[model samples]
Target: MSRNWTERDIPSQRGRVAVITGANTGLGFDTAKALAERGATVVLAVRDAEKGKKAAAKLGANADVTVQELDLAALDSVRAAAADLRGTLPKIDLLINNAGVMYPPRQTTREGFELQFGTNHLGHFAFTGLLLDLLLPVEGSRVVTVASIAHRIRAAIHFDDLQWENSYDRVAAYGQAKLANLMFSYELQRRLAPRGTTAAVAAHPGVARTELMRNSPAVVRAVFPAVAPLFTQSSERGALPILRAATDPAALGGQYYGPDGLGGYRGRPQVVASSPQSYDVAVQRRLWTVSEELTGVKFPVG
Candidate 1:
């Protein structure tokens, strides 16, 4: 019902502290750039410190930007990053879970969990839980997770074989992970509601042309070059939804944002609905429990 939202709509983030993962490139980088431009103290939590520093440099010396090493694929790295952040930052305004893998060959993470689920869902679950104390004390602080449109296609939590050990389907696995992201956001919102300090939100880029596609299927990659202009939006445009979710004062907990075009492929960012399945509360709780058990991380809320 509201007019189309753009980065220009983002309120000034002066004095706010935002930490975004995978900020070296693509949607994450764009999100960071927009926030920095608006005067937010931005921290690029990336796997490669050098790349993050390079990315921060592009934001210019005026932008208060820093880099922290984080590798979502490894739980140890996630723990170390969280501990380091807790020690440095007294409070956090935004925690954007933006880094993720997509459609990579069937592989396992350092902890032997499926790569997609481990890095995309469980890793974030642990990281957010570990850093939630800082966010819980900061009013208006938010935990925004970047989900995907793939969540509606071929996605279902395979509880029995969550690791994809029995079989592997790249698309399905990716869908499952994204779906988990959405569910996690929703569940987290419900948990954070009592205190009313921090909000949990989700957003999707909606077919943005970004480096995330480097691991996509060969067929998609081969044809992407030709169809990208026609079907996909630029990384900056794609990041609008995420930016809105992170900075929009009107945005509430449990909200999801994405493109407002045909099939949600492209256009301006707007509040959008995720797949019906993503709203399954029972499944969300189950996933949360399992995630804690697997990651050995517990949240202070709920």
Candidate 2:
């Protein structure tokens, strides 16, 4: 993130509209708070209505925030939410695909896609495409995708079995989903760069103390708790790169950012690079093709 930029520097967002998934807590909540505080009319798209409403209320009694029920794992929910948002929001300045599940004891989404991959990758993929119409015409419109360094552990996209039914390993499956997120961000950027309809950028919150890992098994959480204090950063700080990517004039499409120090676990946000696997054009293309087929959503053909 630009060193000089902060909530104090966020310019007026008076009439802007933003939609953030999983805005009930963690990175998503903090991100929503920052934007809403800047005067943006933020829609906290969440799976649970009560939690979303409570979180939005916490932002401020009169904060320009609304709670919308959106379950990413359910395409029907996503479609309905998109339609609702398009009607309510004339334009979308930012779509933060921040909601996701991680490291759960092998489960499946309502659609039967592996829970992690389904929620983290395909969910956002379809959501963005469906919401693109609202986003494309807005000046300075952007779609900020949150990926993770764990993407490096993904062994390719697993073309033959994306659902991972044959060999379902939780961590690898999660990594594959994250990798798909990066590829989608870059590919979307490439496709939209020429016309400048919008930009797609990716950012990772380096090992923040957020609830991203709360779904993990108790044993795993305890093991990591040993060194958690030494490294984990706050969720608000972790949202820096995403806030920067969404609003910073200098942020470019397809660029990825992360923490700048200590193995990228925590520090000021800066432009960062992913592992070589994330740069594979073929894998990215294949992932996009498969995602389109699986989600039954197509990008705008402008």
Candidate 3:
């Protein structure tokens, strides 16, 4: 509960098996790198094999790491990767759903769903469900879903138009996706509590300098790039909340972590609360059901 929780506070991860999506760059890379250094066998589940390999290599020669292709934008790819992971790993101590897309041009995923919603929320939703069995049997297992401060913006489930077929606002869509991430974590935690086999927690990078911002608008692109270093934290620092949510002994299920600085833009990791909208039980359950229906990947647990 200290104010200055850093990566050094992460407990020894020896013998643990971790699967981190989008581990090739940004917060995911730093998260995977830190865990691998702490002795966890990490699988950098990425969309590109070459990038994953390069990322693995960056962790140094001795880090127990490997690459698994996981393209969250595609449902078939998510299923295939999950199946492969289940067959290979006997147990998973940590499953970090850290991959996401920011404010990009209007596009649909392979399934014809909105790109950000599909990749950021639905993709991880399906992947986690497919692999929940692996974590369900392991004691102390944790599922860390990476959300964002954007969830507090113009976010809603948008059930009537989940794909934004009629209209699209990049920032609003991104907010919906991020909001769904937090909702998924809370709902998953509720389901996991009874089984006592795993915990679901959420963390945010707190405005760190990462490649996820490549989709920013023209004005933001011009100004953000120049001002980022002065205001934003490094990706390494951004990964702290994630690492903390994954390894902090005192961290509880359904809890959220982010930077403790003013407006949560940058600082050390600490337990932080999400928007009240994120905790809406009705919306959470509805989204869960809708996600399962869309992905056809029902979790083994209730």
Candidate 4:
């Protein structure tokens, strides 16, 4: 593998199908573009169908790109989208759980889950579980989840009040959600390893200039633009880690990919380590159980 891996290093994706959430813009759009350019049939699973269509249009007529309605904030929408895909597609080569919320105000999903936790973690959990069978039988199938550096900042699985019913701190909620994304990937990989057909991997964009941070604190939103050029990379560059995780033949289950720069802010993609707490097997299992209970979705692997 190249030390400074970029989109040029991606392997051929011909004849494969990639389903990416939040594929309308930002890192997700870049990932979809790269795969489509490499001959993969890309499905831009997004909350807004119009935006998704516009995004697919940007990929040009030569690209085999389609749109699927998938609002992670609502379990009903996740189920419907999964069902639609399962009904249409015979198999899926890549399932990228990439859509997410950042520092939004105190809010909840349709199912009453905290906005970040519900959409970022639990939504993907249900969606993945509901669609795992499609990837399980296919050779070299992968479930590439996008996590974040926030997993290491003020993050923990607060089992006592998982939904922040009593108190709400947007930053902590986002951290917990991102951390859960990592934990879900690791735990899912552990379960899929015995099967040896589908692999689960995680990646993070570092500090990419994207709309995900639109809801960030006012100070950050105000100051981020001026310093963004120095501190952040383009969405295309930020998508490298995710593209690698989804396409790199050398990538293995339970592995993570992120930027190679200082503090993982910007650079080419490389294998990276997540926070220590994300490796806790006990917590991972517990979170899985809780997710299943909350979403009523169970994986075929276990």
Candidate 5:
């Protein structure tokens, strides 16, 4: 329940392994760095190979960090990265589904799925299932998927038109994806329970300074000039809930953590509640089925 996670809280991670997606920058980068500093061998899965390498190099604080190319929006890249990691490491203590795309000009993934839903939710869903085996044998392992307050922006998943092809609304699609993250987290906690108390927690960065906001219209970015200081928090601070969910003994399944401030905007991390619709079971199952099909991956790990 404690929100704070200093170095002492992580314990010695000598033999453990961690895989973090989109770790080339933003909260993912900070999370990877923090874990690696605690001795967890952290894999930086990123879309750009060059940026990934630079990210690992910048993490001079953590010697165990490595860069691997992973394009979350591209199903092929996701599968290849998982296969490559499986080839190298047999077990992983933490799997942080951290990388995500946000409000971009209406786009589609390499597989043609809506960009936000594809990368932020479906991609991570498949990635975790493919890598589920890597964590089953590790004692007290976990997976943390990043969701957002934007979940409140929309109450439920649009099963009728999940791809937003029928009617594409950028903000709506983003909210749906973030909500999928929470639903997937809870559903995964159920799946991972038999794997020995492995947690499937969800966290949000509370409007941190990340490139996720990039590609937003100029007027959107302009808002950052005045109210920015109040609305935004640093990526390092935003990473606490994720690090805590991954390493904190007190963290449990189905919990939502985010900054504790105005509308859960900017402060320390704490257990929080997401929109009520996030707990819909049928929606969770539907999303999972769609994800497996989209990614051409299977669950039921060894």
Candidate 6:
């Protein structure tokens, strides 16, 4: 509800099914571990099945965990993983779009889109759309997208060149993907509100010490070590916002959650706000339409 929200605040997830991408490490692993410990059947949906298995095995001796192969950079992989999940999971109570690429060197996905945008935004878009029907009919079902504070730094939806084909700035491109994440959640919430069963919420880890920063610039990479202890929190703590967005009874559609300290850097989870551009309904709708067109995956809901 306020500061100090932790895994202990998570309700009994007795029969819920959760599918978390990039669950092999960092925030995703912590999220999956917490949900599994709370009695949910958690699927560690990851690009690397071997790492996923390792991560699943560490959850607990008795945790209900499964490893599903999902490569967010590859559209075919997304479809294949979604098809497998469709056959395996009857209903998914939580869908955490937790996996993402941060500041990697310029690269393109197998689909020829920029790697970060393709993996971070469009892949989850297609996966969620493909699997949304399972959640739509279930009460309390939620989709919690993990965005980042970087979304506010320098982010925008580049409708003219969504793939960053003309020019590329890894930082701004990452921002675009993160911004798209929030916009997607907001727009999806608008669509889900009328559906009467599912809700879409967004969250950020607020600069936790995670492997997600491995691709950052050399200076940031060099400086992070010295400042980490002073500035960053652990991945376990970083995961609280996501856990709250997923399980907190009062968390509502379109709500965004993040840390509550030091410009949202390191503290307990709380309901936070995102950038003004992230709330633009027109832009959200446009991105949604373009996403559907690009990914060839359409949501079952309006």
Task: Give the alpha carbon lDDT tens digit for every residue of 169-227 in model 2.
Answer: 88888888898899999889888888686889999999888877887667868887898
Model 1 lDDT vs. the true structure? 0.95
Instruction: Write one digit per residue (lDDT tens) for candidate 4, span 97-173.
Output: 99999999999999999999999999999999999999999999999999999999999999999999989999999
lDDT of 1 at 196: 90
After superposition, which runs of candidate 6 have C-alpha atoms over 4 Å from their true positions? Answer: none
Candidate 5 off by > 4 Å: 3-8
Worst 10 residues of 6 by lDDT: 1-10
- The TM-score values for the models, in the order shown, are 0.98, 0.96, 0.98, 0.99, 0.94, 0.98
Clash pairs, candidate 6, are none
lDDT of 2 at 195: 66
lDDT of 5 by residue, 1-302 (tens): 55565535766777888899999999999998888887889899888989999999998853788888988888788889889999998898889999888888788998888999999998898889878888877778888999999899854688788889987788888999999899889888877776674678899888888888886667888888687788888888888878877877788888888888888778888888888788878878777777777677888732
TM-score of 6: 0.98
1-302: candidate 1 lDDT, tens digit per residue: 35677888899999999999999999999999999999999999999999999999999999999999999989999999999999999899999999999999999999999999999999899999999999998999999999999999899999999999999999999999999999999999999999999999999999998888989888998999999888899999999999999999999999999999988999888899999899999999999999999999999999
Expressed as tens digits, the lDDT of each residue in 4-119 for candidate 3 is: 78888988999999999999999999999999999999999999999999998899999999999999999999999999998899999999999999999999999999999999
Candidate 4 vs candidate 5, TM-score winner: 4
- Looking at model 5, residue 184 earns an lDDT score of 87
TM-score of 3: 0.98
Clashing pairs in 4: none
Whole-model Cα lDDT of every candidate shown, in order? 0.95, 0.87, 0.94, 0.95, 0.83, 0.94
Please give the RMSD of candidate 1 to the true structure. Answer: 0.9
